[model samples]
Target chain A: MERLSPRIRPVWLTAAIVQAAVSGGLLVGGAVGLTRATDLADAVGLAESTVVQGAIALAVVLAVVRLALAWLRYSVWRFELREDALYIERGVLTRVKTVVPFVRVQHVDSQRGPVERAVGLATVVVYTAGSRSADVAIPGLRPDRAEDLREELRRLAIESEGEDAV
Target chain B: MSRLHPVTALTKTLGYAVQWASVPFFLVSILSGAFDVVRIDWVFSLAPVGFLLGAAYGLVEYYRFEYELSEDTFDLASGVFSRRDREIPFRRVQNVDVSRGIVQRLLGLAVVSIETAGGGDTEATLRYVGEGEANWLQREIRRLTAENDEIEADEQEGLEPDPTERPEPATAGTSGDRRPTHLFELDQVELGLLSLTTAKLSASMVVAVVTAFGGDAALGLVLSLARPFGGPAQLAGASPLEYAALALSSALYGAVATYLVGVVYTFVGYYGFRIGEAGDDLVYERGLLQRYSGSIPTEKIQTLSIVENPLQRAIGYAGLRIETAGYGPDGGGNQSAIPLAKRSRVERFVARATGIESGDFDRPPTVARRRYLVRYSVIAAAIVAAAGAAGIVWGLPYWYASALAVLGAPVGAHLRWTNLGYDLREDHLLVREGFWRRRTHVVPYYRLQTVSTRRSVFQRRLGLASLVIDTASSRTFVRGTPTIHDLSLSTARSIHADCRERLEDARRTRAREERALSVAFT
Candidate 1:
């Protein structure tokens, strides 16, 4: 199994940080809203400042945990180009190992989302004929590399001469 | 081009009248405000006009509907104001089903629906066609599909899985050698047996139907009628043994009701279930009030599923379902090819249909057995905890009784592990699983769409993974995707590679075979 490009680490970290920040921001806003709009803290016999402090503390803890797990997730993520199929092993808690044979691949595409674009990374997606687990994606690759991978898989899929028909 | 049967005018008119008149009638009543504040009794007159319009629409549809059988395509033109025309190539036609309800049957008419490769909806439907025409259309389409294969084989190469060329199916029909070889016919005894073993969940639908027809008052009346028998249980001096006996007898009564309901359901659904082989096609005709005659090319069958419930398994009888890419009437791609058959006969049928050999399954590793034991034990413990929690909350006694389930966890786990096994053969992949209704999915390598493996956190620690094999069939009646619950990571990878190679090899061989057939055809 090959790990994703080392460059993907920063991009994943950025995404995880942004996600955590947004969630933390929402928590802060909710805490402020509750303190201002209702006497929930007073009714619960707790000070408003304590609620805000708790939100900030919980936010920091969650962010730290999320960023730490993100590092682990990056470490665990892997993709292997087998002779006849593309194998991907991912997920942190629940490990998923998927093998999409070249013959079953209907189409392939290389996409660069905002986060990926920010870090000069691209993702190559393989759409298979199967309904479930239809889209297989290889994330955190250079644009040129993603394009090359897509072309190679497409060529292999074409060469396999799958029925494409039932 | 030919118009729809004249009977459609009458049939569609009746159908539309009911459908259309109800809307205006509903609006008029709603606008009338329970006939209190608003006196719009004159608005009721609009129902007749709507009915007339609907009748006219139906008649126009019948007259305007025109279909033509060309050399390669089936053309259809219909619709009122917006003219819609569809041209379906014979090659794309997956299934041709002829079905009829009471009205159509009485009128000697059938609704012929055409199914294609994409989506769940029926591609084209002829409202009411002559029974003879429906049959002819089915036969003609099959012939054209075969002819198309011969012509397109050279250009398209091995892109299509040609169902017709395999058995030289259509030439026999063209030569007028139309003798159909009978495969399986459901008998009275077999139907009864099938009904008896049916899931009680469906039998509860009998109560819903009864409620729909007779209302809640009737149900209350029934309960009241049975109150005398139930009253004995509530009697102040009732013995514990009497109460236990009453509960047992009531359970028996419920079981009997389920059997009776199942009898009616299966009997109606599969009354004259007769499947015969006409060339390479399995032509099935079944039903009591609503009859259906559909043909699924044996070569196009994606998967073969053998379902045997505990009772059926004990009696050595099983149900076989034939799945193709074309969706069936009930949104599934499976047809009950053999609703009830001898287990041995079912095995033979599966072998004949997909070349799936009957052999011993390779059981999962010893860790899988331990995994099941651990899972079941946890579940049992959870139930005991929940029972205790509920007891404390509600002040209920006998909370300890639920703990007894933990003792049976080992037996449950053993049975579950023993039942789960898979056999990867040369041409077919057989996966047998499930304890209650054991389903053995026989998926030919030719139909293998994709294969994937997954493992949860607990499984990863145990070095175990699950394999999921998919086919082109979309209906997730647990149809094409047969999954093996537990296998070593290395074994899973090997199996995945093996499956991928086998699928490619099978397709290559099948393509070569088709090329050879095309050469012979020309």
Candidate 2:
């Protein structure tokens, strides 16, 4: 069993906050604009200021909930590198556990997105011959660790090539 | 190094130029303020010049593309601006097909499509090869794939090649003595039945044609014609008698048109359809206009499917499909081994071809039925309520009549639940599902790529989960994955574990079989 780098928390939180903030800004702007352009505040029996403030509150609540979910998601995510296969346990609402055999590995790649690069973290993706679960990605690893994992999986896959997993 | 038939360059260049003609049109439109500043006639004239430039680019592309067959790999290198090289191992090759269209026939050329494992579609298309050369290449590729396996086996056993025993490629005798052990060709009666039944599909095509040309106005006319039987004739105040006559005439016309379309499509597709077994491979050839012939190696098969629609089921007829890891030339990952045949015969054929028993399936627990009932009933209720609301809003008469459909919800749920079953036999796993069009899938244990159990929030509340069985076949992703739904959580977990363990055993069995076969060949 393995855990992701602890530094991924900040990246996840930042992404969640940015996503929520943009939608919140749009909502607040739309609410304020609607009050000035139409009679929405009057129809809802609320003052213009109250409507705008309500929108702000809703946006803040949504952001907080999203942050909580992200934390929970991080806690639940884990992977295991077995002798013959790789197993992953993930998801919060609709839980999913996947098993990818070593011999099925078609290729492997290690990537560093802008956010991950800033945090000195990387992600490794393992591709398989299967159609649906074709690509499996493990994020939030130190760059050196991600490379090691990629090399190890590649070697293991080559060694087990005689098994004809495809 | 090998060069393709010289005419291939011409055909490819022409196709490339014609396809690229659109780019200049868009560019001109954008530059000329959407053709306002530029004269329409002038723009039209400029298209020819675009074609000329595109032809030049096409020539470069044709010259750049190159392919060669090596001892163990098929190498391809193609690019105009940058170099891209790929080497596909022979053992990974799944299917090799040769096809020809009218234009290719006129040119005395054919296309060779080679598909490999994990290759999305036709991995390589050697377009416009001489007809005789295409056939030779097809047979040669198969020989190389077989030889690759033997070489690997020998290498593992540390055996040196005996030059005296192994024949030279140039002198290898090509004979036609390898005839099919079992063969099936669609008869006239079966073809007629297939055409008539499949016209139901083309009925949708008739509707689409009506929609494309007639649009909403024609639909309204049809609706008015249909109104006498559907409800009161209020939309069109014409006399009921005249409307009923028009409705009958249009209905007859629709049926005839649908039947004609269906017959043409079916006949054209399945004309001279023949499937035969030549050694360990299933060879198929079909089509009236554009001919297609391919071979599917038995061991490369991922699963076998037996499909029966309502009409076919009533007549004891079924269709058989073989799924593989990669797509064929036409991008149909699943090959229709038999479009229509007797159910019993198809079953026997599949069993013989795949060498696996189609065992009886075990039904899910009764509680799963309750869950399906609840889920389907809820969906039916939602649809009814929405229709009722829409009816009232649109001032439709008898708004409450939609409620009648909700009562039939239990029937739908029962059919769905009854059809859902799975069997984990000794050698293979069987999953039978689908109510409208029943499909029974026989997946050998070795082809079970991954086994997973998923639980949604709703499933958790109902103490149920779904077990998904994945293969390397591409159809598993596009269509519904072969999932056994509404199993009790415990049952799902146990089945998942059992399936994984069986998969391990199957792998060992596969290795042993390959070893034995190699030894026998040696």
Candidate 3:
């Protein structure tokens, strides 16, 4: 279980890159405008070029720091299915735990987007009768693993219902 | 059971023609105004003459409409010069809603709207019938349909019971007597509590006020209070205290007006509120100033819900709304048979009417956690913070505004979310949701016509999906729950599968039991 999955690293890397690009754009725009409006470059006893370079470096460093934090956030997410319920634990610093019983299940749906399909993976969604936010979806499962899990859960849910196993 | 009076169509046609004639009259008025601009004085005189002609045409059309009843079918004929005929089989008629408008009250006529399950635009209507005749027709239709169903059941069993022997009441197990069961009736206290909880009254009052006083006045008054710091000078130099006094007085006046309108509307809408069992059907008759009578077959009612608003919770009152199949103006086109009743009473009623057992669940439905408060507050807080920050940056006083926002937004959100809940029992699924006017719907396992599951990308990441259940009731047609998930995908699939299997099992068991009974009797 401790063995690192190469695919997982790329997923986090891609997300971090996207976040960095957005944050970088905003920070650069703000710093550049501030530099253009103020005479601080001359008053600071530093060349304007040196001040501009410093500002750009500071913004890049900030974006990189934020991206590293996000990478750590996604790494902690984990899910497991037990005999009676499905369990999920996820968080960066504040942990969240969720348990959904088999009997409360209403319907199940499987979905795959371009990214997931490219990775030969699929997501399974579970719905209950009353709770909208309580619904959960599990993604990044290999096709075979997802199908096997679906079958196993279906069996467990039917047995738990104790009436019809259609 | 008796037939409807033949004058229904004529009265209805007269009403329809009068309504249609208004368009042409308005168009002619505009045309006359245009002509007057060019000094055509004679054209203006034609307006009144046109009105008279339109009224005369309506009267002629009214007399031409007529309908007759036969043993298994009802026939209607209408149209002045060109005759249009409609034939409706008794079995196809889903429900009969009899209502009386102001005109009907004056003329001593009742209007009957006949609905059917088949997907067709044609609906049979009988206008200008005596109230007594309308009631008789309703009973006749119900009796005929019930008799047909019993015969069909007997045929399926290959044995027919004697017609002389009375069939057992549907609620025989719960209620001792065979007399039609009255499920629940709202007393004065229950009615008052219901009025306090629901905004139906206040919403209607707002509509009435806006219509009476132009929208501009309403908007101006609202804007003045919302941005009070804009100063008295902004409101034409009125002193702060004077403006405050005016606002307070106006609010007091509005509140009084709202209360009166609410009481009157409630009295009319739910007057003589009654829910009773008649054969294999449930009947609802209400309205004070105008009467509305409708009936739903037990088999056709797809879902039943008992809902409680905050006010109702304090007073122990809950509203029961039924969802049925077929297309009506409202969703699922199921009518509210008993709009308001005590929660305890509604629970007892559901247990008695349907064979399913009823009790409080070990856990409230998960949707209660997703209540309106949590969802709305999250959005409201973000929006308000952003707005407050922008306002402060723009040199506006933000403290007072932010304080007011903080006080109201979260409370409103929580109230909305707290009222939402859903429970999936062994035999039925119940959904309770509403912010101001709460409603709960109970849907039986067998009556579910379709089940669907959906998921968005974010939901997929969280391992969540939404499930929708559709029934035949028109009332629940628009009120179907969009997102109900507390289970995993496989679990949901199994639940759907189980429900379908159980439904089949019940059908087979009933058939086998009927067969065994018939064989033994023979």
Best by DockQ: 2
lDDT of 2 at B309: 75
- What tens digits encode model 2's per-residue C-alpha lDDT throughout B204-295? 67666875699679766666656555533444675545454555656765777777877887887788888876554567888888888887
Q: How displaced is residue B459 in candidate 1, in Å? A: 0.9
- Docking level of model 1: acceptable
By TM-score, the best candidate is: 2
| lDDT against true structure, model 2 | 0.75
Name the best candidate (by lDDT). 1
After superposing candidate 3, which stretches have Cα over 4 Å from the reference?
A1-166, B1-25, B32-45, B80-83, B101-103, B118-122, B155-183, B205-260, B326-332, B355-378, B389-396, B403-424, B433-438, B476-478, B481-483, B509-522
How far in Å is the alpha carbon of B80 misplaced in model 2? 3.5
- Candidate 1 lDDT by residue in tens digits, B275-308: 8866546688998999998877655667778988
lDDT per residue (tens digit) for residues A20-127 in model 3: 787777777766776688876555556777777777798789777766766664566577776556665544533444445565455566777776776577767765
List the candidate 1 regions with Cα displacement exceeding 4 Å: A1-83, A107-127, A133-155, A162-164, B13-21, B24-65, B78-85, B154-177, B212-214, B225-259, B354-357, B478-480, B511-522
Error of 2 at B288 (Å): 1.9
* Residue A44, model 1, lDDT: 59
Task: List the candidate 2 regions with Cα displacement exceeding 4 Å.
Answer: A13-69, A158-161, B1-10, B16-41, B157-180, B199-263, B329-332, B476-480, B514-522
Choose 2 or 3, whichever is better by TM-score: 2
Model 3 misses residue A57 by how many Å?
A: 30
lDDT of 1 at B271: 85
